[model samples]
Target: MPESTYPRTALQRGGVPVPPLALGSWNTWDRMSKDEAVALIRRATELDAGFFDIAYYNMGPHAENSRTDILFGEALRASGVDRDGITLCGKLWLWDWPNQGFRQQLVESLGRAGLERFDTVVVGDYGKVPDMPRLVAEVNALISEGLVDSWGINNWQIAHTTQALDEAETQGVVAPVVAQLKYGIARRSMAEGEAYGALFDAGVLTLQASDVFEGGILATGRQPERKVGADVGGIREQIAAIYPEVARVAAGFGVTPAALGIAFCLSNPATANVLFGASRLAQLEQNHAALELALAHGPEVRAALAGCWVDRDVRADGVW
Candidate 1:
């Protein structure tokens, strides 16, 4: 099925025509063969989940050396899909920001991915912007040079993002067009808390939401990693308890629990993209199914669900 079968493709911020659903390739390198990953990308295109995301993050040991981007580059090179057809978005982490040689990094990213330019480049997290002036200059310069098309911040709450955007606009620079966070049933703060308020008020980031599975918590229908922190334990417990309930509700709605999450996420007016990951073609089929199910329920039902989520903080922890 073409990407048209997917839900909303209007990322309004960058004029980037990205399907609401995308393939997330984070910390997945070193786990699969290059051919296997390329095949996955090629298949994702067919299903219209052509928007692909990777990160050059320094995850202590697991994702050192821009592992995600390195693997994604190989996958892109071998994907056999036309670069023009698929949207490529990558993340630049704190370890490599500002003077990280913006164009040089893009050159390396392009060489790794075998593409001339990335459709979008995002800050991996809201870590200190260091030199705000230098950051904006480098970001604008990338767009001007055509090395990167769109730029945004990820994982940073709205306060920093708001200030950055405000500064860029005041300075007549290209402000970020997208903002992302680790949002899911387990992590509601970004959606129901300050981050949402900040972006909603400013009208900058068209959401590029991530962590739908909550680092395997929602996907496995169980507890979260202890590393997710001690503070969120109660939230994790809530997710564990509510997962089956969600599954039941999804069943009543004639959809799966994951489908319910996807539908609910897309229903939000601010959400332009819901980032997801897959290890196989079968997962893309599930993505297609989720989209179809959400469509069947219609935007009204989805909107209702979305609102309930925000107002009730449904399935999210720490709402009280």
Candidate 2:
């Protein structure tokens, strides 16, 4: 809790400590060369930011047949970074839930990653409401089987997240310790709003800040021709329009907009860690400064970007 210390805490119920940032594998991670991936992995570990949120990316809108998981496995093996030295958080897509089954997804994802187990698995992205009891039981079964050490919810509604925790607690099973949501300078409502904030405040859950850059749009201060994550509240344009203000504020802090956006998320007391995607080693190195930024001028940065906290109506409904 010291000002100089980058917060490291157990993301799992009784698991090893994780750092303040996690590298995400979603869009551009698959495009990295093996050597680049290896170097990035090494540099991330060197920075003590070795936690990873890896996924197979072969379901729903992500069914582009990406080999990001496979590539990461290859890079890890070549990087020679000890597997035990890093924490891996995989994803279990609820897109095709009961039919595909968590077990099959777990097996296939681990196989793709060339790993035997994930330290944590996030059950995410469902079209409809899933059976809470069944989901909780399956996650518990995975824990017992040692396929995953722990589990958490991703983009889940506040009510459903509470139900999952209640079910697990009532059944005398392990419950989630973190809630991964789209949270950043532009997207703050879900993670900081009354419902989810209560969970974090009451010591029931910690926030995992994801999409801090809105898939590079917020970082670049310009919208790409390609698509991005859910435009919840139809506010992507509003978010884009506010980029100049973000850049202006970043200029005052003597940091890049991307670094300030990242630091803003890390500055929040409720955020246990922030997930960021970088395609280059330089980008990774630049982002490492965010920890110091968060430590030194966190409150001032938060207050500066107060105007960019748009999309207050956004909630964790498990859709995006």
Candidate 3:
């Protein structure tokens, strides 16, 4: 395996340092055994990729009241990894916001994971437009209360995210430092498009690239068995239609489609971290090649992928 040459990025405003890659435990934890989970964590720490995106799934369509949080907590303790050496990024869903509230949600999530605090928490998807002032105030309160070091947004509307930045500024408090969005070779509009791109360019927000492989469809060149992200503007079929082109390009770079997808996200100047999931150690090791690919062939990778999904200019939507 190649050495990890990807440099750390200091997220805007919060100054939270993150590696170019993070391990996301979305549809991953429950599938692995305790030993597998412990080994994955140990290996991630050794590779300087200890950051984790964990959440208690109890909201939206994907919600199944999973105990993956508890499982991860057990694995962490059993792995004997140093707590201070890793970063934990949790999520607070907004499906029942104002009623459920950030405080209660954060407490429950922390309790479930047996963790003291999350290094950062992403304020997650909402059913409708949210009250920006209240949201900002609560997020700032969490920071002051030492519950979370920093916060970010997930799959929010362009205007809503901008309003969050403004509300934080008006309150004279810490603004959100990152925006996690569906960014990958198969989908590029929301993150790379004009709206969020401007925020990134202006240094008001950093990009946390998510769904980089389109739920493994882009990487495998086949439809996944499980449900994936919504097909906004009906772009999934179009993305599938172009898989051969994507594969050809990846082959030209002597990399897998997965590596190409991850490299595409890391090549962007605004990207703070790219979140990917691995159910096995081999998968985790293979994905790390993306950093080297990004370092050595970033420009060419970006240029090669620039023409893909050009028609996917739809707004960010769905139960993310």
Candidate 4:
């Protein structure tokens, strides 16, 4: 399928357009070598997956060495695609949620990406509610200065999102147009149950990550080695047992496990874009297949997958 034929969704802020599916470089690029990471990014772009999400403080103590954004910039230059054809997205780390820190982080992200501007920059999870006001202010400053094309928050609850929007409106700044969250088959309640209704009512778009393979559970079909504690391990095993069923459903539709996993997220009407993490070129190719499959399914297939949601509590720390 042609790149233009792929499903496109527009965000509420700046009416900026992004593909329904985006290539994410969170844990994938964090663990891979620079050369491998760059090749996978270029391959994703070659396959017409133009949206890429890179986080600055992903690798914990070695955060300084976390050059995913820089590698992505190099890949983009190598791909020979015009900057306008790509949508680059990044986040402000939790540490940068303080006064004017978000703006400073935006400048750093732009410098790493080697771009004059970014399509979207999300304020990663705020550790405190009070910081929301300052973060909103910083985002507005960046947007007003043309340093950021659009701004939003990630993992914020309904009340916080509403508060931010109200604050932005009071200051005569653009309210956030997108909410980044983990929304998938087993993880629908937090996003799709109540919070999603509130966001929809308030006219906020959603950019969903971890749509599949949360904590490497779906991809490995085994308990994630990185997960700690006994309770989390038990929950991981339970979720792992259900992977075969997920794979079976995908087989019925002639798709891969990853494709079925992503399709489950694309089924949601509120989802403006689906974000996926790929560690290698092969994984990027597989995710590209999911994007095409989603486009082919259209409305009916999405409706069917939406009905197949299973309730489970999958937390960032571990399985809840």
Report every candidate's CA lDDT: 0.65, 0.84, 0.84, 0.66
lDDT of 4: 0.66
Clashing pairs in 3: none
lDDT of 1 by residue, 14-102 (tens): 38578777877665544577887888888777876788886555433224454666777777777667878888886565555544656
Alpha-carbon shift of residue 296 in model 4 (angstroms): 4.2
lDDT, candidate 2, 185-206, per-residue tens: 9988888888888888887888
lDDT by residue for model 3 over 1-320, one digit each (tens)? 22446787877654757767888877788879999999999998766578899999898765779888888999999999888878899999889888989999999999999999999999988888888899999988999999998889988888888889889889999889899988888677788788888889999889999988877877888887875676656777788877888899989988888888988999999998999888888887878888889889899998888778644656543222
Q: How do the residues 14-115 of candidate 4 rate in per-residue lDDT, one tens digit apiece? A: 476676667775545556766776676566666756788876654323255567677777766766666777788778776434644766777877787787
Candidate structures ordered by TM-score, highest first: 2, 3, 4, 1
Give, for candidate 2, the lowest lDDT window spanning 10 residues.
1-10
Q: How do all models score by TM-score?
A: 0.82, 0.95, 0.94, 0.84
* Structure candidate 2, residue pairs in collision: none
Candidate 1: what lDDT? 0.65
Q: Residue 89's C-alpha lDDT in candidate 1?
A: 85
